[model samples]
Every structure is written in structure tokens, then in C-alpha cells.
Target: MEERKDINRLKVVLAEKKRTNKWLAETLGKDQATVSKWCTNTSQPSLEMLMRIAEALEVDMKDLLWPLKQQ
Candidate 1:
């Protein structure tokens, strides 16, 4: 079975919101380096964390996720 890797749209959302990585890091009480990883798609936040991020950014969770391609 092939593993599917979903793209993370964190950086785009942050850009649209005019939010900096530092701001998100501080808001989430996480390290700036950690948030940087998320922005670069080098790592991902958990679903719960994503929820908090969406709330903090005033956006829907779906807005932080890349659209899946139609198979």
C-alpha cells in the first residue's frame, strides 16, 4: 500500500493572515523553531494543535489544509 502525504498549507494561511511565525509560536506557547518547521512543512502540528491555530488565526481548519486531488 502506498502512503499518502498530505500537504500542509500553514505558511500560506499565515501569509494571508499577515501573521509571523514568531506570533504563532508565542500564541501557541511553542518554540519559534517548532513553528518554523510547521511553516516550512518540515513537520506538522497535531489535529488539536491545528484547531487551536485555526482559532488563533481566526480561520477554518480547512483553510490550513491543502486541497486533496481528485483521484
Candidate 2:
């Protein structure tokens, strides 16, 4: 059996919230480039940072993640 990794859905959530990477960057005290990386899924935020982002975006942690596929 192959193991599957869950996908990141941060960019979609940000768009649904009508927010920008710059706004998230300011909210988290991070650089826009870093936020851009996260939004693009070029890099992922640490679990701790993910929690902070959820708080900043006023969203549930699960909101940042894509739902896992059922076998």
C-alpha cells in the first residue's frame, strides 16, 4: 500500500476569506514572501505556526488542511 500525504489548502481558505497574503503576513508578524511560499505550498508552516495562522485568520485548524481521501 502506498502512503498518501494530505494536501495543504491554505491558499483556498485565504481566498474564501477574501484575505491576502500580505494581510496574513501582517497578522502573523511574518514577511509577505514567507506567506507567499506557504500560500503556494512551496513550503509548509510548522504545526505551531499553523495554529497561529488559524488564530490569525479566525478559522479552525482543519480549515487550513485538505480533507483526506478515503480508500
Candidate 3:
């Protein structure tokens, strides 16, 4: 079986921002479980949702995504 990759950096960003998944969920009016999924990389948010997340987090959209290449 193929290994799963962590694409979104939600967990790290949340930690850096001192925010919790539940707080984000409530802010977005979404279910906590869904926010947990996005944080764990078990699933990803849609582009539109990503925009909302960025807006709520006060960060750029690209900040939520894991960089494909390291500098």
C-alpha cells in the first residue's frame, strides 16, 4: 500500500497560532471532527474553504499548504 503524505500544515499552523481545532471549527461553523481531519491530513479542505480558513486564521492561503520543496 502507498504511504500517506501530510499535505496540509494545519496542525503546525494551529500550534503556532495558539489555536485549537475546536476553536477553528466554531469559527468556521463546521464540525469539530472535520477540522480534526484537515489538521491530521486524513482529508483536505476545498480551495474555497481554504480561503475561508486563511481568512479566519489571518494568514495567506499558501501558509496552510505544505511546501513541495524546501529551501
Taking every candidate in turn, the Cα RMSD to the unseen true structure, in Å, is 3.6, 3.8, 1.7
Better of 2 and 3 by TM-score: 3
lDDT against the true structure, each candidate:
0.89, 0.87, 0.92
lDDT of 3: 0.92
Largest lDDT belongs to which candidate?
Answer: 3
Model 3 TM-score?
Answer: 0.88
Clashing residue pairs in candidate 1, if any? none
Off by over 4 Å in 2: 1-6, 67-71
If scored against the real structure, what TM-score would every candidate get?
A: 0.83, 0.81, 0.88
Candidate 2 per-residue lDDT, tens place, 1-71, comes to 99646457888889989999999999999999999988887889999999999998888998798654689
Error of 3 at 11 (Å): 0.7
Per-residue lDDT of 1-71 in model 1, one digit per residue for the tens?
99756567888889989999999999999999999988888889999999999999998898788754689
Please say which candidate is ahead in TM-score: 1 or 3. 3
Query: Which regions in candidate 1 have their CA more than 4 angstroms from the true location?
Result: 1-6, 67-71
Residue 49 in model 1: shift from native, Å? Answer: 0.3
Deviation from native of the Cα of residue 68 in model 2, angstroms: 8.8
